[model samples]
Target: MSGFITALFDPTMPFVRNAALAGFLSSILFGILGSVVTVKRIAGLAGAISHAVLGGIGMALFLSVRGIVPGLPPIVGALIFAVIAAALIGVVSLKAKQREDTVINAIWAIGMSLGVLFIAKTPGYADPMSYMFGNILLVGGRELVLLAILDLVAIALVLAFYPQIEASAFDEEFATTRGVPVQAVFLAILTVTAVAVVLLQTFVGIVMVIAMLTLPAGTAGYVARNLAGMMVGATVLSWLFSFAGLALSWELDLPTGALVVTIAGAAFLGVAAVRGLKALAKRAGRRAEGRVAGQEAGR
Candidate 1:
């Protein structure tokens, strides 16, 4: 405990500070965007976006190695791929109606395969595990800045169009009748979500990003009275899970991203179990009350 506290406060340890900042920023994005995703029932779409980011990362790494785009960062490639994937998915979801999953899954698989092909063709060793599982400790100052910028963008867009998002998410017919520009707003949300997913992939990697995005928000859904409340609750829960995961990773010498996801998964399961038990107890109580009422009527 003492060592952990010292590491957090130690000015010499920039990585620790970076991790803390990354966690906080990521939680903000996850909390807000995730609430919208959950409310809109777009978790599968979010999963597809997260997985597709791998293609961008692979393409970036390949370009960097081949000197084709020496200045292009992996995140840039990831950002581009994510946005494109999100846009395509958004369009398909809007128009394809019956074949949305078919298109999304195809994109998801092709993106991952494209990534693998690029990585395989690149010279020297490219650690696929790092991108697949994530290494939050590897997050640096530049990535921190990028995350901050994304947070601003997400917050601004969400705030500016909260009414439209709420209307469209809950009732598309009503929203359209009210002239809410449902398609535009929905596409905007997807774009924002894609960006958020790419940034978060830095922390939890491609495979685990969906869990990180959905679990906390899903947990928050149980207690929050509204979308705003859900975002707030999810943010708080995300912070708790992230901090605890980081601490545990430090103490136990574990993978930071995996630990973070595990912590979230555990919390989600716990909440689900508690809710289940409560529901079961309530049902039992109702049955008992019914039995008593019948006995009294017989008397």
Candidate 2:
């Protein structure tokens, strides 16, 4: 721990500072989007989008290496693939409810397959695991700037459309009946989530990043009174998990993305277990009270 702190403060290691910033910024997106995604019960949809980004990343790498599109950034390609994936999923969800699972699964598998093929055909050795399980400690200045911009944009959008988002999230049918444009809102959610998936994938790795997205929000759900409260709680938890995971991974030489997700998963599961036990205790107490009342009446 001391070593990690020392390294973090060392003037020579700017990347460490960038990485910490990245975690903080990434947590903001994870918290806001995760809350809505959880409420909407679209984690599966978000997961598909997260994995689909690999296809764009792979394509960008291939193009850049081949000089077909020299210096093509992976994020740009990832955005394209993620947006397309989201659009398809949104249509299937809204129009073909019965085929939603099938479509989601197809996109998940096909996107990954395409990515693998592209990486394989690239001239040089490009390890897919590097992209799939990114090292946050290596985050650069460009990424941090982009992340800040995304954070601002997301916050503004959320502030501007909270009512519509809240209405559409909980009860789509009711929201639609009330003239909420649920379809547009749903598609917009998917699109925003997809773009976030693209950006965060490069830093956190798409393989298990969904865990970070959902786990924090899921944990917050236990105690949060409302969606806004849940978002605030989730954001705090996400940042804590990210920082703790980053520190532990640095100290122990483990994968930062996996570490972050694991910590979040543990915390979420612990909270859930405690809540379940509390509920059971309440029910047991109620049953005991009823039995005691019955015995006293008979007596």
Candidate 3:
């Protein structure tokens, strides 16, 4: 037992150690962005962005397989295309003058279809399942560096613009009336969300990314009365889920992304149940009090 434990903790255990760290950092970053995404009522938009990355990943794989961009990294290509898609979504939604959900649905469909078609056409491209589900075990130093920089930028942006984000999220027109540059703030938030989606795609893939971004935050929101408390609680919950999921996946040989999302979903359900029970209890108490008051009045 001692020997096995020693081997498991050895520095030679490359993938497990590195993957654990990557998962931890990724969870923290995603949790923060997820809080903002939920509060802004743009959770659907975040989902759209995550799915849209499939198109970017497909395009990058095609270019690389064809040797058209032999020197360019697929991730770099994917990130570039994802950002462009995000910008286009922003521009179109602003110009369409239609319901935001309608515009987002159109963009989501188009992006996903393009990605599937591109992947179907590309020869020698790796399995699409890997992109859809993620490959955390394959994380390297380069990816970790990228994650670190993006995480720092995300944290800094949240800190610097907390008040503006709070105002805009709760009331856009009021924020604008207060000279908060609502449009600019919206654009900036969307851009950050897009980048975060792309980063999370590398770990959990598009299908599961939305769960990572929303579930923890959603659960946290139930117990949190303020933005700061919500963010902190969500981050803590996300980290717990991520670490537990990773460990469970390792022990059971289950899919890591699926396990992570499953844990988060369970947490969400648990929180909802607790909240519902409390609400029911409160209503019961009110009814009981009202009945007692009526009996006393009659007496």
Output the number of the lDDT-best candidate.
2
Encode model 1's per-residue lDDT on 1-299: one tens digit a residue. Answer: 45766898899998887887888888988898889999999888988888888889999999999999897788888988898899889888988879998988988898888889989988889977788888777789888898899889988887888888889999999999999998988888888788778888966687657876799999999889999999889988888888888888888888888888889999989999999999999999999999999999999
Which candidate number maximizes TM-score?
2
Model 3, range 180-214, lDDT digits (tens) per residue? 99879889888888877787787668766788789
Q: Which stretches of candidate 1 lie above 4 Å from their native place?
A: none
Ranking by TM-score: 2, 1, 3
| Range of the 10 consecutive residues with the lowest summed lDDT in candidate 2 | 204-213
- Give the range where candidate 3 is weakest over 10 consecutive residues by summed lDDT: 1-10
C-alpha lDDT (0 to 100) for residue 114 of candidate 3: 72
Write one digit per residue (lDDT tens) for candidate 2, span 99-213: 9999998999888888899999999889889878787877889888888998898899899999999999888889889899988888878888887888888878996568877
Cα-based RMSD of candidate 3: 2.2
Q: TM-score of every model?
A: 0.95, 0.96, 0.92
Kindly give the number of clashing pairs for every candidate. Answer: 0, 0, 0
lDDT of each: 0.86, 0.90, 0.80
lDDT of 2 at 161: 91
- Summed over model 1, clashes come to 0
